[model samples]
Target: MSQSFAIAVVGATGTVGETLVQLLEEREFPVSDLHLLAGRDSQGHSLPFRGKNLRVRAIEDFDFSQVRLVFFAAEASITLEYAPRARAAGCSLIDLSGALPLEQAPRVVPEANADVLDTLSTPYQLASPSAAATALAVVLAPLRSLLTLRRVNVTACLAVSAQGHEGVTELARQTTELLNMRPLEPRFFDRQIAFNLLAQVGVPDDSGHAHSEIRLAAETRQVLGDSGLKVSATCIQAPVFFGDSLSVSLELESVVDLVAVREALEGATGVELVDAGDYPTVVGDAVGQDAVYVGRLRSGLTDDAELNLWIASDNARKGSALNAVQLGELLIKHYL
Candidate 1:
């Protein structure tokens, strides 16, 4: 028999939040009753669910205890303020904010770290990595079993949508305005992002690497369960609108054949491997696709121990909403 549970999606009106709800319906999750939540401005707005429209409620006024599962897809600031309150109310939390700085809770990419569920005394809490991090982690996870990942260096080309709808709009607006010979006014990013790529995705610290770059290494290591793995990241904000891609170079503990490594990645879940003959691009192949598309597979110039690959995936779907939904399914299967 199927089990039904009350569920809530906070930040229900945003890009990822809407994607999460869409996935819930498409996957036919056992949702008995659904709640939609947002900030005061968005409260009273209507979002479609299960056919009819579900009225959005203010997060401050909603009771968390009414739902068995709660997905925090809201802005990080909003999530930071209310997540603890919801956890205290006794519902399982799947945080997608990536801003969750809790040391106790694991930030998981479900395909990479389903084992995390086993460690949790209860499925009442977990966090998901950002879209870019998820893209990088899922690709590297499968290769891990065949070869011990000693070190990894990633250069991520992130979509403007990483910042949300505003980022996308900002890019479009800037591009159109620029083409018309109008001055581009930037709001969502640090600089003009229509035709240019920004080397740093987020504010840089004293170390020279931006926050997103720093997060990539830390979160990838955490999700891959390799705390000491030497991982370096460089995050670039690309002009594209939806998909995120990564150029990954790995230094492994032992030598691996090209066929063996490609075969390993092909067999990995949530990963789509494209060989040398075929090419995969972010806009052409990865947009609207759930799986991480990996191509440009070959040996790095250094040696047999080094492997290089290019990967792309939908930042909104596979990166945030889909991963959270996958973990939500895991919670339903194991704990709920």
Candidate 2:
């Protein structure tokens, strides 16, 4: 890789896309030229890059010839359409959708899987795991490194922004109308999301597990490199605007002390340990932060080997955009 590289940011106007741009600047990734690509509806709009405004271009019309890397934050369908072309154009693609399975494409978490990303071919590519999965992975990394993880049970409280801008607007509108004592109308979500929580994100399968829950469970095991680990998850949509919170319980191989556990988490990268006594973390505080804030650490009274903790992160940033950008940096350092 040269001192500076040409980069393309697909879906350049969405929440995650906006964060990607900010992170690329904050981290000082070498970028000589930046191309912003979005859908037809978003063309003609401009977003600030570095200091000047960069106009959004229609994805169909943007040329990938000079692009050395592509950071995709668009829908899975859009990724499916353009990822291969960008790769064939000799550009490394870092996807942020679950459109492709891990077997076909590398499933990456930069802090946990940087070694896997070290080697890449001309068309090498990968997608980030889900927000819920990413949060759990951060919590599980230190534990997996020290002890054998047997099983994990997680319940995720996700924000409306996870559904995109429409979900956020719908929640706000519903809140205002309810305060005025008017009838509520549902749109982006299956049920009312304001002043309430839904235990479902995607449709439930015959096994009674919602798709988001299933993905969290499966993806956690994969990212932790523990296929034999048993995982059960429940995903809920909260009224919050940003951040993802997870209450996690782990069953380990042997007994572990709380002091040892705290040390492990505190020493881990991309994670911060907040002592429950003085500084408690919330969705608002977790937003715009790169590290996952973990607090409320406790031990299972019934089983000494088991541990529980509360973890939170900005789902759109640390969970998605920052993770993608981190992978981009890794690619630049190792393969670019």
Candidate 3:
């Protein structure tokens, strides 16, 4: 480890990859050199970094030998192919893919489980959860800190942008075509995504939960350090481009007051509490913002210990890239 290290960002042309670059520069990480690696199709593309243009290099040709940190924002297949090479090259790998195991890899959210990165003996680290799950984890962190979370139920309205640029473009294209009275076809999704919401994001598991929902439940429990805590989730794909909104209900062991909840949320890092009478925050309003916006807080009608909340965040930033960058920062500060 070095005070000034060379960093490489794989899948530099994708949505999350681009955001990672932006966050790295915005946070002023000590980058002695920055390398952007993309697929062959995106190799010649140029991206801006700190007011300077950086040409993308094909991942096949990029050398990881001298790189100290590698951010893998590419697909799982790409990660499986290159992650080992990067690790063997002696670089610390931070994976944003779901291909890695949670227990062994220590799936991480900087605001939730940054401590996991401190004792990493392996050359790679798996960033935990998806954008939707990450937002829920952040919102729940404060609540879990105050009381024992007995059960959590979440319904996530996730935007197509979580699928990457293709999903976003398909949503917009289909919307425009529909507005023009053209026939709609499903390409990025199994069904129409324009002006419609689908209750499925991934394949259903044996437990009858979609993969996204399962990941949310499992990752939330992991981040909260309560494996025995019960959780159920329903994941839906909305027409929006970025930001994910979650309606969460929690049954806690102790009663929680609204005032205390508001105070805790307001004081929590990377979170903003919106009081009543304000416009309900939407997905568009949350895009590009790093803070998790929480509002619509209420108590259960029949249960004093139960609480409900609406939480939203830019899935790509707070949920993915920005969080990964923050993890890198934490690793450098505490571990390196």
Candidate 4:
């Protein structure tokens, strides 16, 4: 008989959290019992899984000991508050919030940093990197050996869904009003988001870099296990509703070979490389897909050592929920 275990999904009402539940069912994970939990405001809601609706309960009163594994899919503060409790109850956890310190949680992307899992003991705790980093890592991990990697610069154009349901609603409202020629008022975003791009995703620090940018760089390096690697990241809010698009430039120590790079990417896991002269876009290529789509592979006109590429990925599903579930799968297979 196959062994099954009890599992809990925190923030079960949110976008990523709901997707986590769906993937768990779609992948046929060995979940004997599933607990859907959220804050008081979200309590009483229900989510369907395996042909049944599971009622969401309040996280505060739930006993962590009942579940062997828990997914922290809510905001960072929620994870900060409850993760330790889960840990104290001997429940292994995977955090998607990027709240816990790297030294403590240690980010893990199965494709790039599965080895990191081997270093940890039982009751594993891991972080699923940001959407940008996850996509970058998946595309870059296989290429690390092909090139003498020096620096990577990325401009991530993310969909409004990155901000959660409110951002989605705001975009829809703004777009409808604009189409109807109604007066526009910005709410969720600082300025217009319909048919527009906000250069920054979140508030910028005194250094003028948004928090998302810093997190992208830090998380990418951590997952790649190359702390000293130079990473320049810029996250912009795009008006789109779903996928994330990235423009990546890599500076290598020696001249890059386009043939070798293409072959490497084509053979890489979790990657779908498009043919030359063709490009992948969020709507047509990446949304709702598991693979990270890469195209527009070319070398710098002046700098032979530079390589540039375009990436499209599904941020909500492939990036956040799926990765966290993969971490749970990894834990069950070995560490747990």
Candidate 5:
């Protein structure tokens, strides 16, 4: 018989957490026993796993010592509260919340920096990068050899789903109210988000940078293992329901060859290159897919040293749940 281990999925009722449970079943992860946990309000809910419905218990009431591995797909506050408990109980954890610092729980995307895992010891703590950073790193990690990257600029058009179920529900409600000619009152968002794009995803800091932008840049640099890489990230809230779209421009040390860039993206793992004439959209190509769809490959109009492209990916799945599961797989196979 194959060796199996006990695992727990914290925040099991949320979008990413629920998806992580499904992937754990779909991928046939070596799970001997599964525990589902969430906040107080989400308790009593049941999620199906391997043909059985598992009830989600409150995280506050659960014991961390029962599981060997845990996936923290909850909000950052939740992860911050329970992570130390899980760690003290000798549970290896993968966090998708981006709450923990890099020194404590290093950001990791298996496609980009699986080697980072080798340097760590047991009772491992890892972070699945934010959706935008994960997608960007997957496409950019492969191109490091083909180009001497000097700077990376990204405009990430994020879907409402990135804000969790409340954001999605609010978007739907706002759209319906507008179409029905009813008064528009934004609840989850600060302003109207039905047909308009919010320039910034969150409140800006003293430097005029939103938290998401800062996180995207920091996580991208860490995952790609280049601390000195210049990354300017802008996160915009789009009216879409799912998936994230990114417009990327890379400044290189020398002139870039279009053909070589195309070939590199084509061969890169976890990336799909769209045809030159046609482009990929979040709904059409990336909503339910694992690969980051890349299109509109071109160099800068003024500078040949610049390379530009567009990327679309499912933020919840490929960016959050799947990456966490893949990290779990890596931890079990080698580290654990």
Candidate 6:
């Protein structure tokens, strides 16, 4: 007997949103009735799932009570407006947008924090950690258990696609225009992100931290359950179409050998250890992959009690949509 249920995918037009739909089908999520919802402009759109086309509807007209689960792939503002309404109508909200009220909703990374399942009294749950934060959190999970933590410093080279489909298209368009010797029009991004790297992922605040930096720091700490975890973040938007990479350094309370570190990483779920000769890169390795491919493991040069790592993963998959779907599986097993 196949157990099936009604599911709604809000924001089906977005990249992460569409990825979630694919993952849901790929994972065989027992989706008996699938509802695709998007904005007014996308109302007539149709997306393929399991070889059939599902018509898209305006989300403003969606009836949440009819669905058992609502996966919100919409913008934070849209989620804010409707998540509560969906919950009020008796549906579990899989908050892929990372916009849920943090204190009220448990931010779940199943590989790192499955304990959230034991305390699942709330209707809201987070399906995302900032890609930088997700990469950092999964890597840190094994280390946090082995050593007393001190501080973590990371620089994330987020792909241009992190901003959405427009970001990807803009990079392509600009590259073509530059090759044709035309003047670049910086529209989607604040700066020329065609062939160059922007040191900050968003406009800086008074504290000199970009929006990505702040989100990475705060979300990393929250996901790790370490309020005092000293996280210093530097985020840059790299000119790649997909995959996100991170350079991470950690100062621990004690020394850990590289061999043991490798063993721990290999044992961790949603993580994979790269061999010494092969370094993990965005294009060569991580795009379309589910594992957080990690390499460049070495003893910290300056400090004996520290370690360094280079990590990469598909920002759209393991970082966001896949994590959400994995959490949804947990939600079904424990609560639903």
Root-mean-square deviation (CA) per prediction: 1.4, 1.7, 1.8, 1.0, 1.0, 1.5
- The true-versus-predicted C-alpha distance at residue 231 of model 6, in Å, is 0.6
In the predicted model 2, the residue pairs found to clash are 1-336
Q: Each candidate's lDDT (Cα)?
A: 0.86, 0.84, 0.83, 0.92, 0.94, 0.85
RMSD (CA, angstroms), candidate 6 = 1.5
| lDDT tens digits, residue span 116-211, model 4 | 988887688888988889999999999988997899999999989888899899999999999999999999999999999899998999999998
Residue pairs of candidate 1 with colliding backbone atoms: none
lDDT of 1 by residue, 138-250 (tens): 88888776888878988999988888889989999999999999887788787898889898887899979888888788888898888899988899989999898888888
Q: Where does the lowest 10-residue lDDT sum fall in candidate 3?
A: 276-285
1 versus 2: better lDDT goes to: 1
**By TM-score, how accurate is candidate 5?**
0.98
Clashing pairs in 6: none
TM-scores for all predictions: 0.96, 0.95, 0.94, 0.98, 0.98, 0.96
Off by over 4 Å in 1: none
- What tens digits encode model 6's per-residue C-alpha lDDT throughout 189-301? 88788889988887899978887788788888888989899998999989899999999888888886778889899899888889987799989888888999899998777
By lDDT, who's the top model here? 5
Alpha carbon lDDT at 151, candidate 6 = 88
What's the lDDT for candidate 1? Answer: 0.86
Q: What local lDDT does model 6 show for residue 129? A: 77
lDDT of 6: 0.85
Cα lDDT, model 1, residue 297:
85
Q: What are the clashing pairs of model 4?
A: none
- What tens digits encode model 5's per-residue C-alpha lDDT throughout 30-105? 9999999999999779999999999999999989999999999999999999999999999999999989998889
